[model samples]
Target: MEPIRAAIVGTGNIARIHADSLRGLGDGVRLVGAVDVDVDRLSAFCDRYDVPARHPDLTSLLEKEQPDLVHICTPPGTHHDLALACLEAGSNVLVEKPPALSLAEFDNLIEAERKHGAALATVFQHRFGTGAIRLRAMLDSGVLGRPLLAICHTTWFRNQAYFDVEWRGRWDTEGGGPTMGHGIHQMDLLCAILGDWTEVSAVARQQARRMDTEDLSMAHVSFAGGAAASVVNSMLSIREESYLRFDFERATVELTHLYGYGDDDWRITPAPEFADEVMGAWHSGASGVRSAHRAQFAEVLRSLRTGTPAPVTSTESRRTMQLVAGVYASAFTRSAVRPDELSTDSPFYRKMEGNGPRW
Candidate 1:
């Protein structure tokens, strides 16, 4: 098969992940071109990656190299426009998380994807990790039985200096703090595991960070499958951890890691009556893969090759992003918000801040 012609849009830290992941895929993918507004950074990135061409913006890169896929690693605020442009040009796009600034923006991109012949996918790498894959399989197979309760916590510290990067923490740019920028990874995985959510009642606080957005958010989410999850997204913790716990009728599963997790990070405890079978299944579950950009990029390639939509399709991601926006909407409105309430007429659908944050 011919290598996939790929391009990176940003030269910042996350873009490095995209570039490296693309390189790791070997002959199946090619780093055809790259783009960045900053000339020096772009040149340095292209030079380091040995990219064939570099352009000032997406338009130039699209017009020249005509990459088969464009990875938008730019700021959350810029994702919609860049992704829209790529899709409009008949190029598939795999954009970084928070795929858009708001549900409105996300929906627009969805429309563009349907209108154009190209595809659009969101980056929710945690869902692709082998551990998550195995767990989902078990749940689907009824080995774990029905999910009862779960906890999804992404507690990591980012000092004030980290937010000084101009686009780091703001309602308009970063899109609403830890819940959007940092914890969305774990949260997306949570949604992927539990399926659709029914309602959300959340509270957000500015906490320790001095920014235009909250540094912490807490919420209770009820899922359609009769499961409830307690979620917390915070950047104020000193001893940071990304933790998730799921309790099933037969067993309890837990994963603990700061960012990406491997098989060793997962633990399962089975109810006495079902202990033998559950442990045997857990022991035989898939292993030897860590959750990261490369793990997901491989899946993206497979889907493209098979002529199917990529993993974490926009519809799947919209639910996760709905939970994010729900957190903001519920916190600001001081009421429980349902997924249906985030419709066209809803303020939260129009903007994540939803008529600005409560504070």
Candidate 2:
């Protein structure tokens, strides 16, 4: 099979992950070009990665390089426009998490994808880990019975300097606090495994930062399966720990990636009562972050090759964005917000609203 040519946008922190994944794709993929408005950053990225061409903007990149895929590594707020542009250019797109600022923007991207007949997907590579895949499979197969409750405890250390970037803390730029920005992976995993949430009540704070948005957030979500969940996400902390624990009717499953991004580091434990059920479905040993990213990239390439379906479709991404908007609205109103209950009048439903709540 011919290599899938890829152009990347944004030369920031996470762009390295995309570049590394492309390099690891061997002949399955090639890094065709990179685009960024910041010429200095764009030049630095191309030189560092030895990419052939660096375009001043997406329009030029799409016209000149004409990559088969556009990997959007830009911030959440830029996803809708960039994705639409890529789809219009007849290139498939793989955008980073929190697909867009709101469910509406996400819907716009979805429409654009459909109109262009392009494959548009959200990047939630964390869900591709061995541990996560096993857990999802077990749950899907009813080996663990029905999940009763879930706890996603994700805490990390990011000081003020981390938000010192020009657009880090603003809702217009980066979206919400940890819940929308940092903990989105866990949220994605939660939705992937447990299904859509019915409603949510949340509280948010900016206790440790000078940013315009909250640095901490807590939400209680009720899933459609009658399984309740509590999510605690924050960047204000000393020791960092990222964990996902699910309690099922037959057994309890837990996986933790607190140490950072890697598969061998996860721990999966099942309840003693359901030992047989869990053991029968046991599967572990993931390659690592690079491998997971590569796995998703390969899936995207396959979708483009066969004109089939991408693993994480635009509709799925819109659901994720809806959940994100629900979290932000829950925190904003100090009330419960339903997953499908966004009003046209809701501020979160409105596009380009100002920065989220402040401390």
Q: Count the backbone clashes (under 3 Å) in each candidate.
A: 0, 1
- Taking all chains together, each candidate's TM-score versus the true structure is 0.99, 0.92
Looking at model 2, the pairs that clash are 242-258
Q: Give per-residue CA lDDT, model 2, range 142-238, as digits (tens).
A: 7888888999877998988889988788777877668778888878878888987899898788788988777888889999999999998889878
TM-score of 2: 0.92
Error in Å for residue 253 of model 1:
0.2
Name every residue pair that clashes in candidate 1. none
Our model 1 lands, by Cα RMSD against the true structure, at: 0.8
Candidate 1 lDDT, 103-199, residue by residue in tens: 9999999999999988899999998888999999999989999999999999999999999989889888878899999899999999999999999
Shift in Å, residue 339, candidate 2: 2.0
lDDT of model 1, residue 312: 79
The worst-scoring run of ten residues by lDDT in candidate 1 lies at 350-359
